[model samples]
Target chain A: MTVEKTKTRLNIGADPREFQKRPSWTNEDILALLDEEDGTLDPRIYTDEDLYRLEQERVFGRAWILLGHETHVPKPGDFLTTYMGEDPVILVRQKDKSLRVFLNQCPHRGMRICRTDGGNAKSFTCSYHGWAYDLGGNLINVPYESEAFCSDFNKSEWGPTHARVETYKGLVFANWDKNAPTLLEYLSDATYYMDHMLDRTPAGTEVIGGMQKWVIPCNWKFAAEQFCSDMYHAGTVSHLSGIEAGLPEGMELSDTKIPTVGYQFRAKWGGHGTGFYVGEPGMMLAIMGPKVTEYWTDSEAANRAEKHLGSAERARQLMVQHMTVFPTCSFLPGINTVRTWQPRGPHETEIWAFTVVDADAPEEVKEEYRRQTLRTFSAGGVFEQDDGENWVEIQSVLRGHQARKRRFNIQMGKGRSGVGNKDFPGSIGYVYNEEAARGLYRQWIRMMTEPSWETLGP
Target chain B: MIDEKMRAATRQGDISLEALSLQHEVEQFYYREALLLDRHEFNDWFDLLDEDIRYFMPIRTNRTRREQKKLEYTKDNEFAHFDDDLTMMRGRQRKLMSDVGWSENPASRTRHIVGNVLIEEELSASELSVVSSFIVYRNRLERQVDIFAGERLDVLRRAENELGFKIAKRTIHIDQSTILSNNLSLFF
Candidate 1:
């Protein structure tokens, strides 16, 4: 393939690209903080502003981030507004039935072109000025163009910057870097586990509800890391109270013991990770009531799902799993609370989450899933409250000078983690281990230091 | 059976002298509940609900004016911001009381403003449908203040006595499509 540098697209004074490259931290300083072999990390990685700025460029910029579900914009002219990293983006369904993701800022003055969260529109017109663009984000009109500007001014050259859009099993993803690997290649072996949520039924999945958005006073990585590798938190430190409270009436806490049989999968190359219990649905029973659990495990629905999924174990036994697709996207499989942790500076995160269910599932089953997620994972969710509290408290402590002086101990089952499991793929480990956490920071630092995908790959 | 009765009652909009009297009584009940919430009497507030109550808040969507007319909220059971039975509500209260429910540990101060009280209908001698508007302003710590405005559709049931009443069912419809607050830990 031949490559060519396109000319400057818009006439917004001194290029915004130059202004965005103003971070004052060096790669050496950041790399020194993350000791990959020893599984230790400096707290400064969570508290520094310059490091945060560099992360926006190195990590979020190159990664393939999830936009929304395909069913969210199923028809032509449908659109939804979301953020890729901190940049507000508009995901639109074009006339040809393909997807387009573009920066929401107008080229004329850098104001948002589409203001509302989402809608169907023939074209988007800037509310600040009268500049208009088609669903493809191609510039079509500028109010009073003949009288206000020179004849040499061209409308075709002033469209919003578009990202490379792709999909896997109905989930939409986009990347800003053209050189980055395809979404399939970037996903690597993580797809096997993602199928537990996205591809269980032949009819596929559809987003069940509107987005639930809320802000938390904590860094984005804290949330991402927890989802990727922290199933150990479920047994202690957090969620035990929630689990005990959610237990059935006739059963006592002593009768229901937390399951210890599970495996954690850290991706071979990318920072993706997932963990799930093997033969126990105890956590699922506590979080999602007996009705939903029965439907997910023993009902005819489970039979059909196992047939379509080609694994009885995955359909019936893989209960209450959590996963993260690196930099931002995170979700729980049985609970099905999918979210994007949009970073807002270093100390805050805006969580935009939604729920999905099999399109072919019974209405009652779908309703049960919805209700269960509302009680267990949303902003007011019981388990969600526990997880957010720890992150918020840790962030508050990171503001202290003494807190950043020591390195966090992430050495749980470090070298003892086995190579692979016969049933599961990727590098496997016991349920309670920090191997995935080490893999995450190792990938993070590599992305920050290396300039291209060729050097960053396994 | 209660779900069906509550659903039908909330859909009716009949007004009568007896209905207006019932409306007055229900309005007073709401005002008292608001005062209790503002004062942080959560345990006492818990007693105002029936043992089998269904408290729900459906997730709202931001559609164009035309699309808004189609359906402003998600389906009754499809997605809800808060869907609590009596047991779940009790659990929430228990968590808040414990020192671990950090969302409410440094508990937020809230003032629930209830207005536009309307007795939609009198479903039966023992059951009445009531609708009202509310704006809850919550302050946490020093610099955080969030205002949530919404409407409540409730089924108020008369207890054995003439003066006692309980909320059998409630459906809260938040105004903003996207909730701006950090969490919906505070009740409306």
Candidate 2:
């Protein structure tokens, strides 16, 4: 296949970093709110506007945010428009099979550079003012340039701000900070756990069923933290009813026991974390349906994955993994529902999500992956509704003054270290604990307060 | 195998009904189904489905007008909002009826405004292919209201001596790329 390369050339160009006025909150205020010692959290962290603004600048600005799967824009000149902390960005596949991510706003009047969600485009012309830009977001056309402006109105200088783009196993991520750690360095030890989803097969993964997006009234952190560490919710009533409904014919909820043997890996840096059962696939069975469960755990696919992933036991373990690659990227390994929690405001998050399946899997297996994800994890999914309800209700409650003033206890498994569990890397804890949540908040605080990657580096 | 043949024939609009009187019967059947849903009489609504029904609503993705040739949904047997056969549909009904289905504990008051019924074809003496458009207005509690508009292609089979029909298959094509509703907890 001939990849359609971009007509406009890409240079590192000028770095895109924001210089905002001093905010009302200080580093001390944020630190005091999150007491890492006792694991107490102020509710304002989910409700405060000033802190949210700081987060967009200090956290999302520097962090490597997962944009979309590379398959979404595999052909050159194919672009997917999405958001990075409320700033619209376009991820385009350039000629030479490289990717370019840039702000989607026009330099002329700040309208969107690409109006559609995803498509193959030679150039994107702003509908508002008719300003056209090449695939690399370089301003290539100005309507009636000779009649409208002087010779100094240089097209080369008016392009949209470009972000540093990187791809790890077909996942495209973009970062605005020029000095931040590379994507791999930022991923740290999280890659080992992430590989459970992306690197399970030699052909790797490709996106299926397109994007499923919806809005929820909740802080993005709530969704991120839950995916990072909250296995506690899974065992609760949040999923029990859905799991019960998905049980095999003639089998009751009491027919099987929910697995308790699982481990949560809190990242050493970057707030990335993952948790999964070692030898249980009950959740996988419930969410992904029977066809998918067989394909995922049966001999043929499992053996191939074991060889490629290089962990024979883990590959064949029938494990159901839940993971977050920091800030917003979260995915369920067996279910394969990958989503980004895009922060709309302090109290609203727009969930943009898609599912990925093994590229070389049988057509039927791929179809099952797509079908199962929609039925179990998409915007209208059974499990997704259970999760969203909790977040929405919590956000609604935080509207009260007293609710905003109370402290949320996060002291599950505090001081618990991975002393005995040598099987997994990083700080490990029981599945139903807040060890990863603490790690996430700790990293969030550090990122918000520290000015440079030098100070934030592990 | 016959369902595929029937669907292909229906899409081809190969109308074989000599008498168009059955069109009124099919329209009334759909209206009754809508009424059952609007009244939240789920078990009664469930009875309208054939035991081997394949009811589905596929997720539609956004595409430009120029890219209209590309399908909005995934390939056959791929992802969908619902891919329910009889047992799975029963499971959904059971969840909605349960007391702890949090998303629907206080069920959203729904109106499945099924209209534009067109009896497109006669697949067999017993089966008729029908097309219809619907606008479902759902309101939860005192606030959140979501409206979903879509078109449904259904395969209806003649039931016993009654003029009513049973829906053997329904493919609901929702118009919105991103569903504005929180959950598709209700049947379309």
Scored against the true structure, residue A180 in model 2 reaches a CA lDDT of: 88
The list of candidate 2 runs beyond 4 A from truth reads A1-23, B1-21, B71-78, B161-163
Give the TM-score (vs. native) of candidate 2.
Answer: 0.90
Q: How well does candidate 1 score on lDDT at residue A83?
A: 90
TM-score of each: 0.89, 0.90
Error of 2 at B181 (Å): 3.0
Per-residue lDDT, model 2, residue A388, is 77
Steric collisions counted per model: 0, 1
TM-score of chain A of each: 0.93, 0.93
Off by over 4 Å in 1: A1-23, B1-24, B38-43, B90-102, B105-111, B137-147, B161-163
| Candidate 2 displacement at residue A242 in angstroms | 1.1
Model 2: lDDT to the true structure? 0.80
